[model samples]
Target: MGIGEGEPHPAGSGSSSVEVVDVLRRGELVVLGRIPSASNATLVCDVVLDDVELRCVYKPVRGEVPLWDFPDGTLAGREVASYLISDALGWGVIPETVLRDGPVGFGMVQRWVDTPDNTDRPHPSAPSELPDGRVDLVDLCPPGAVPVGYRAVLRAFDSIGEPVVLVHADDPRLQRMAVLDVILNNADRKGGHVLEGLDGGVYGIDHGICLHSEDKLRTVLWGWAGETVPAHLVADLADLARRLESPDDDLRSDLAEHITGDEIDALALRTLVIAETTAMPLPPGHRPIPWPPF
Candidate 1:
């Protein structure tokens, strides 16, 4: 069956946020198949609750690949934490996600996003002759020929030793996602993780390795580094900072369930720093970008 078949309700399809959360929380889950490309055991599933049915990605805690830096089996909770942070900021960059019991055990279930088909277009990592025709978030173009409305991030040689430049669209939607990544301390923002939904929404997914205590903001979206954060986003960040400062704030209490107290404090600090500066950050550390960017 195709992704989200059988009249699956697409996210942002006029369903109230509360209603969507209720369906995901109460739905009976059936594993459809495994997404082989994922490093973890990511399962595509059909979630049903009475007449409402939705397609979702399920990542059971038992299926998580252990990481030395992060505590074991916490990736599922991190995924949910990332969604909470995104929702609190009112950016809606991440799809609706919740942590609950699934077929395999406790895991994260996120609404599946349907991206635009770009199979015929050149892969984002390979140099594209038609830069203007690019539909994805990241692209490679001939050096010194960056497409209009695109920002050049790096100039390097391709596999055949031909010079090329890495670039991403200078889109407001993408810019907002970049800011959200900064707030979440997202360690992996590969080009492939960015999606343009059919509903005219730009989304970021695969947030299993995010919201660490340290500064590990690796991504391919450094196109706007050192630039001023948009005024609206700055305002939102300021609001989020205020909420995080409250000990009994619902957002803070919800996030506390997933991440450690230190990690939450780190999150609050990151939000405050950006809100105060209102400037986009230049990448820190030697390994600022993720390998195989697409």
Candidate 2:
């Protein structure tokens, strides 16, 4: 139930909520003291039972719905997939608890993850340094530690790995992740949210904006356009694409029980979107970045 040093939390595993959004149906929790609604969807608090070491996420009634719109109370089905993936890959996924009764109908509560070394703590989307230059301040989602960062992840998918982000056209792993994001319609791929594990793995966060009926990818990675696809890597993506559409692949939605029929359709559509356009130019008039910074 608790995480210790040198061990990563398991995927699709985390504390669950004892309540839903309807109870507070008309309001929010004010007991979490001076919580900020400005930076990161969460404002740091001691809502969950734990010391400064436990990872905790605060939901402000209005903050919960975005994590995965599952009618308000039930844990998000889509997010659990991310949890499973992150856990399987080995990293923090920030387990959640919802507090209800507000605009969005739910808020989150979970453990607090440590900020990576030589860097500031991270918000759900952007990683930022603390005010006093100390390490423990509530910070934004931090960026990856390039060169040394993702070394493990890159090595895992080495046959298809490219030296850069945007130009990694042939990277099957990234392509698969991209496909997953497209299917889920994830919009919080901001630099800080994506982490390069100390063990060289790749992990991401912020599932609130996922599973939309449209393309919502808005991250700050990918160095350029028209990046070339490595043929071998493309073969891997083609395999995943094929596997995704296969109805027999129960494992596809297994880890995450919150997924719906429509969400599945959205996932298939993601592959189509990419297949139709290899370059996949940014759609017109979309800022791609979420407002309010939270």
Candidate 3:
């Protein structure tokens, strides 16, 4: 069906992960609308199976904008790869994402997360601030007024030259996401990408520019820098490292389809470093945080 032609489908609720993946992989996609502010063409769609329908985000490869640092049309694959890694790590940080054919073309389709403040189809001008005092991983505060459970990352001025401090929550869920970003070499982890689901789960999204072989880790989640990685997370990293060691390993083989062998090797190396060192690495490179840090 044509874009904007269908009634908004309430996103399916309480589906198992396997069911979500199946619907995303085999369902018929009907475009509801476009996420106008997205750098790439991002469509909010309804994926319909025989008796189930779910809202999902579809990023078609044909709509990808070429980037100098990343190869063309690979962003969709990278998104799926990020989901694979998150699934393997048993973190569920990223939503259920799959690369599949849609109305536009082949692309990455991810289950839509229902957040407390967002509607079925989010608009370009949707409020960035979470309602009900729900804390975001990254936030801005007046200089020297950092919240009790937050870590100050950068001190700067806002557009009107008002002093502000960039900070992130000290919650462990966000810390796990930071570690995942390190292993994925995620180039963009803007504050807006972190979502607080209505189901009380914290999720990270927009992982199109991840899994690069280089040290392109740019994020607003520097709160845990220089701290020892939590023992439970380190053990998970160690498990991931072991899975990536063998050529016949399922995770390694699955990753090789989306990213290069060198990139997968780099992922393995990063996982091993964190698993062994058990410490969060300090920000590397001149620009450690992404521009506009949201």
Candidate 4:
């Protein structure tokens, strides 16, 4: 969880903290403590921020082969991946990379996911025996996905009187969140990508694939294929759209720069769909399942 693996070292680890701009990305850097790579990337620390409490997940200059089958180096889509899940969950779950002081310019800071009460990786011999109806928060899929094995969890939600509308239709808050997520090009919202937090909250992690300026809405939520968007969310979508189009919209511009031109069009289209509550598919040629398939 140290800095300066890639970027020039401004100060050594033992140096007194300096201005985040000079040392961190901005003010409000909460050193939540350091951690090690649990899944992918070489990130070894977790930090929190002011306001949105964006978890700064700094992607260090380290990774292994076989992830996404890249076979070498690291995958380039992690930032967008975290964006998708954070938006879907209606909470801030992005790579702490917003900070500029960390080595590699601060994309994600590792937050420690304490060992679960039941911390056994699913048996390799009988993987499906993870229990068909079990409520294990983290599905034991190889490549991490947070949304894939949601049905079992959804069933538990149903037991608690939560409705089981398609992933996109279950919650209006989630629908609105999706609007923001799509605009951000969050790519890794797979079933295992999401983390059910200790605070009764769901926080999405793994952001190396975020902010890509593309129209990538692949997740299990597409089950509600033709559902209409709710009205309250439509108004919210309008507000966000207006803000994104504004000249002062730093977030939008940041995204527009990273993603593809067609991706920007996809973001605009998704926003319009949410604003109008269009009962249509999320995007043409868009995947219906989150990646890192569970």
Q: How do the residues 201-269 of candidate 2 rate in per-residue lDDT, one tens digit apiece?
A: 344555655665555666443332244444443444445556557778754565325556666566666
User: Tens-digit lDDT track for model 1 on 155-261?
Assistant: 87888999988899999999999999998899999988998887788999999889999988999999999999999999999999999999989999999999998
Sort by lDDT, best first: what order?
3, 1, 4, 2
For residues 40-154, write the lDDT of model 3, one tens digit per residue: 9999888987666788899999999999999998999999999999999999999999999889889999998887667643563455555666556688899878889999998
How do the residues 14-58 of candidate 4 rate in per-residue lDDT, one tens digit apiece? 332232222334433444333342354444333333322223345
Clashes of 1: 0
The true-versus-predicted C-alpha distance at residue 101 of model 1, in Å, is: 1.3
Clashing residue pairs for model 3? none
Each candidate's number of clashing pairs is 0, 33, 0, 51
Query: Which of the numbered candidates is closest to the native, going by highest TM-score?
Result: 3
Q: What TM-score does model 1 achieve against the real structure? A: 0.90
The numbered model that scores best in lDDT is 3
Better of 1 and 4 by TM-score: 1
lDDT of 2: 0.41
Model 4 residue-pair collision total? 51
Deviation of model 1 at 130, angstroms: 12
What are the lDDT figures for the candidates, one per model? Answer: 0.86, 0.41, 0.88, 0.42
Better of 2 and 4 by TM-score: 4
What's the lDDT for candidate 4? 0.42
Candidate RMSDs in Å, in order, are: 4.2, 11.2, 3.3, 10.5
Candidate 3 residue 66 C-alpha distance from true site, Å: 0.8
Could you tell which candidate, 1 or 2, scores higher by lDDT? 1
